[model samples]
Target: MMSALEADFGQTPSQTVGPYFAYGLTASQYGYDFDQPFDAVLALENARGERIRVEGRVIDGDGNVIGDALVEISQPDGEGRYPQTVDEARSSGFRGFGRCGTGTESGNRFVFHTVKPGAETSGEAPHINVIVTMRGLLLHTFTRIYFSDEAGANANDAVLQSVPADRRGTLIAERVAQDGAVRYRFDIRMQGDGETVFFDV
Candidate 1:
């Protein structure tokens, strides 16, 4: 027989991220209502930047939309400087972050009103760091949204360079013009063919 200390300590199986995340992680559900939609704006009053819209759908392996997915994004200000604190962010009018849920009726679409992020650090292209969470996800998925317009900068970005050439396009957002507004579409595919290029971090 194995000694008490020598006996194996079985590990617990991992659990999925949600079904409850919508009620728990959201601002309105958390009792902090801003009286506006979740994707309203990242920068406030005095924030300096060219306002733009980023919208996309979250699709699953089978090409079905995942309506309940929650998306969170972080990006630097137009000048490429990130706000260091809450107070600084509010005072400077630069939120530098935003979150939104993919409503079921809207075909799992999510949108964000924000400025185009600039290159803060050298060798890093202007990109938004994205995190996605949903009911069946064991952990949040991470990826970067690169601008299709920045071909030159993107060509030199270390992270972009690391991705295989054929798959690199999965990370770039397509620029579009609609209703006199500029928008970028960046769909996230959870699995199967054409899966978005996710990072290890």
Candidate 2:
């Protein structure tokens, strides 16, 4: 009797988003806008916490800028409380979420202006969850952006500890300041050396 595993079977071809993805996803390009706001301005006025800037670039395996990648980030307010409802988010001036598309002309650079997030809980370190989507990706990738300034908290963070010691630096963002305003720089590498540490979730 022949084993079932001995039979030859064809493999399915992988699918890709291909070109022209922006027509449906990007509002500024084709006006198909989602109901929620994409910019990270949690509030226009009376918003709590210190305002900060986050910026970065998206690069591919070959070291070329992706140029059209879309990044979404979810973070709590400075107090670490997420709004329970859309109405509450709007009223409390806590957007707690944002999406940004890398610039095609500007070499895949993205920027977000929002308040510095606090720890979600007493024990957890302050971090922002990120999701990336782009052409050629069969599934989206997930990662976390950690603050370099939180050395003590990061050392004790459960999630950070779970990652391999050598790869943990990929998740930490570099801190910079301009004109007295704080900024964090985090670059995403899709593959190859120095590739970002993506999470299973």
Candidate 3:
């Protein structure tokens, strides 16, 4: 028998992230009736800015698509302003945040309907901040989606410049046009060659 003090002395085991994110944080995507705080649509039809779609899949080290991944994104409005209140968000029809689960869509892809954000500051480029949570990950990963067409801004972005030149491409979303819609493809590779550059924060 262990003493009371000894029982609590061992290090806690790390827990793997699981599909709970899809069933909980993104409950609606999985057909749950629970109220979803946010969905893939971040910008409504009335939202200001150039409408764009961000789409991608999460790939494992072996290149297999992870269908249970949960992706979240937050960004400012076109003029580089974020809504400060619920009324403002409702009036603008742009929440500036979104969440999606890969399993909900065909091809195990996650998509966000948003507008092209403007530079929030002189040192920063227009980019959408992303957080990924999936099975086997002990902690969520952080990354950014930089538009490939924003060449000048991207070239001057301090954060993008911090990443190595060869690896910076992983952070850029390729521009693509389909069915008269603008879409950006930014696949996230968890490991192996061409892995995405995840931030520690």
Candidate 4:
């Protein structure tokens, strides 16, 4: 009873791989007693550079917030250098990495508390690398967050420049100051209008 396609060797079926990330990766935030390797906070009191909050929600193609999304970010310290040893990270109070889940926060947003990153190279702009994982996705997507305040540096950034002129805005985070705190909003749109520009790598 095998058809031509099934008899020949049809492609394997794909499976959704997420909506279960919190139980394993963000257990602490989900009220699990397990120790999490990292959390939303990436900087301590002694951390150098300007401390800022990055907040945003992951929106689906239908424009609804994705509550079960897990977001991870990594970036160099303010001085554009990464800690090569545990001592350096402890002394600086900057771990250069963070992870957050949208399910715990109101409005289903992922917020990262850390210092603004500096340009790693002369021709590069200050940016935070982002990774997004959620349900229905077989593979996670990668993107970068560039600050709206860094106009000059962003203009010269090779990676940002490589993206098409119009689509570049999708990667820029808007700077906002409220209640005497600095925050940058960078929403990730998975599809449809204003879809974020995800890199192949």
Candidate 5:
């Protein structure tokens, strides 16, 4: 579904939405052939001591696969509250969200890379959340995992409910899965498709 914002500016690149927002303005639903997605590549692994890993992959509107896309995943710190820090990161402009590095320890646990997510609406069963265990600077643990996301399923997600407002964009991710090596090139904020916006209730 093309967002109401994308419909406003017929055919031109934009950096500003209605008035104040100036990021992800030129966002378009998968117009034309979604077969050709922008370059994107990323992955995620659990920090839990189980064989759990969320193999995220990127997919086009037509269900095609996008490769070579770069993705950066971040969440709130322990207590699921990293509002101050994230604002600091985002304050540095694109540099904050653009810096590609390994995952960090937050929210009383660890979070790392996972594959991009498929175009599954929020109403499907628990997909794979590859759960892994990281100890020290070495491969201290490993395992697979299964997590859940339900646009039509649950009104509230545990991990998702831990974030604060305004800074809730931290929960967004274009993570998905596909056949071969895929990538994620979707821009997400605190609303609509592509952007995995969650609540703090």
Candidate 6:
């Protein structure tokens, strides 16, 4: 399981960044189940590793903030899904799916404060793929989270289909909604959702 799973669209051809501190991953896990269109901009860290205040507006099905929901990010590396030691978690971060970095200009470094993406091509498909880059690691790796709500979709996702049948369930996320919002927080277990292998391309 890749920790710190963030989603960012391909650059629009005009974004540039310099080196900065890593404050770990910002939590943008979705807690809404309806067809909500939310737009959120989570905080970005300064060179000092402080949380710069930012806003994430949860969009309603009509494309508006039902109200604003705030999210906090936990360490993206190994909170148990990807197991590592406390000391190692401090020194390296990800000892499973990936490692943190000092931000790069290439296609590797990525960060976002967007809602958990509904699966592509199928609403029931409850999962999103991720690329992880933590300390001591150099390659972008792939992992997934499946939605418990969408079993049929999980069964049909082309990528999920590609994996061995038994291995497929490892990526499923439990969908639990509360306070009128849909929430799916499936931490990736570095040992494959507690014990499985991830991928890199």
Local accuracy of candidate 5 as per-residue lDDT tens digits, 63-142: 43323222333322212222255344344221111112112112122223333233233333222222111111122111
Candidate 1 deviant stretches above 4 angstroms: 1-16, 27-40
Model 5: residues with Cα > 4 Å off, grouped in runs: 1-53, 83-154, 157-201
CA displacement after TM-score superposition, residue 38 of candidate 4 (Å): 0.4
What TM-score do all the candidates reach, one by one?
0.84, 0.84, 0.91, 0.91, 0.24, 0.41
Which has the higher lDDT value, candidate number 2 or candidate number 3?
Answer: 3
Overall lDDT per candidate, in order of appearance: 0.82, 0.78, 0.91, 0.91, 0.27, 0.37
Residues forming the 10-long window of minimal summed lDDT in candidate 1: 10-19
How many clashing residue pairs are found in candidate 4? 0
- Per-residue lDDT of 1-201 in model 2, one digit per residue for the tens? 768898656433222342244333555533455543455455445556678888898888998887767777888888888878988887877788877777543656777777778899877999999988876786889999999999999999999999999999999999998999999999999899899999999
Cα RMSD, each candidate: 7.5, 7.0, 6.0, 5.2, 16.9, 20.2
User: What does candidate 6's lDDT look like per residue over 11-115, in tens digits?
Assistant: 332221111112223212222243322222321221112121211122223332212122223222211132245555335422222222223212222323323
Look at candidate 4 and give me any clashing residue pairs. none
Candidate 3 has its poorest 10 consecutive residues by lDDT at 9-18
Error of model 1, residue 165, in angstroms: 0.3
lDDT of 1 by residue, 61-174 (tens): 998887667888999988898999889988988888888877642565888888889998998899999998886777888999999999999999999999999999999999
Each prediction's number of clashing residue pairs: 0, 0, 0, 0, 43, 22
Between candidates 4 and 5, the one scoring higher on TM-score is 4
